[model samples]
Target: MRNPLDENKLEGHLRSVAAAGCQITLQDLEGYRPQTQPSTTSLEYESQYKLLVQRLVRSFSLEQLTQVLELYHLQPPPKPTKRKCARSIVEQEWNWPSLADVRRKKIDSEFSSQTFPLARHVSFLLLGKDGSQLRQLSLRHNVHVSFSDRPLSLKAEGLSGSLRLLEQDVKDFMAGITQETFALPVKRTISLASIQHISRTSGAFLETVDSQKLRIFYNKSHPHTLVLAKELIMQGLCQVTNLYI
Candidate 1:
């Protein structure tokens, strides 16, 4: 049997029930505005839902829930943040092949040539104080090189050295430093023409290449990379760093 109530009357009945049993207020259904930027309908829906949930408690049924939510218009899920893989970091950190190493080796292979030779790059197999091997550079050119002696250093993964961090870390660490452009073979390693082992009393020294953000950590008489870089900058070397490019 059809009841005599009109559609408006039925809506009013539903609204009254929702008002009593749930938190759908006139404000909830109609929304709000202020002096600032106009709020989106989505926000209004969220606010309404919050009000409804708090008001409804355990009384909200599936059908009632669907009716209220149909107007809300939910947003899509946010995109995921892509993290740099640590292996790539390790490879970049160490696998940086050096052109200078090649130049040095070439000099070693040949005899005296009147031509002034330059050290383009170097890669060292650093042995521990013990006879045991510690690390090996896959390559090192104008850039820094980090290599581990473990057989893993030569993997398709880009030099996977054993008991050592991955190459990606090395790369990322390098990424931290901004490279200065020189006329050289653009983007090539600078070789140390010579190494005179000069040992003396203490002052300061380079702790590590990557931890150079702290300005307070520099001591002049003591030689650290950042300090050396600072001195070089004073002497007209471009100082590029994670903090300053």
Candidate 2:
């Protein structure tokens, strides 16, 4: 016959070991006998089980802990502290899975990426002369931007919705810079057809200055775009000048 008194003594020893943060294994309970009056013993064992669970949970990193809670479909704790999160998991009585399994099923649905092919000069302006603009853009949009000099492109990564908003903002910035005005003084008789062709090719609007000069207007909101527009207009003007010279 198994000794109930010996079982009690073993339970006490296990409790002390648990309290001291030592891992308790099923093998430790191998020789222990079950009690006939099992109610008290069952309750005590339940307490030890929970204690062991908490110790196991605390061993996880904060990120891992949160992931486990999410895998179990539990609401976030009100305080978001590690202790509270672990306690919430315990209180819910959910079965805990291994960390590898939790990570294997982790969802990354919210993340996305976008790329923009920016000209070298345009990239310089967008990122600013000192890179301050790039920093501010990242902070404002809660996204990360990476630059590639060979292709001269900007790649942004973040939540899907934020990426959409960032794309629109970048397009607007490019449009604004392309809208600068270029003035060309009338030295020789310039053909209206030539001016119209320049407008079509450069994607800029043309205005006559009291029949004395011609001005090209780009989208015009950005100072850098003004410089770029002037360069574009000058290239077209050179062709027009050659035609009449």
Clash totals for all models, in order?
40, 5
Question: Per-residue lDDT for 138-231 in model 2, tens only?
Answer: 8888999999877889999998767777888888877766432334644543467765555444445555554446655554553443454456
Stretches of model 2 off by over 4 angstroms after superposition: 1-109, 179-219, 222-245
Tens digits of lDDT, candidate 1, 1-245:
22435433544654566556664433333222111321222335334333333333333333344444344432212331111111111123223223344334444444221211111111111221231222332233112233333422322222222113424433433333322211321222222221111001111111222222212122222235334444432332132222244
Worst 10 residues of 2 by lDDT: 32-41
lDDT of 2 at 27: 45
- Cα-based TM-score, every candidate: 0.18, 0.32
Task: Please give the CA lDDT of all the candidate structures.
Answer: 0.29, 0.59
> What lDDT score goes with residue 244 in model 1?
43
Q: What does the lDDT come to for candidate 2?
A: 0.59
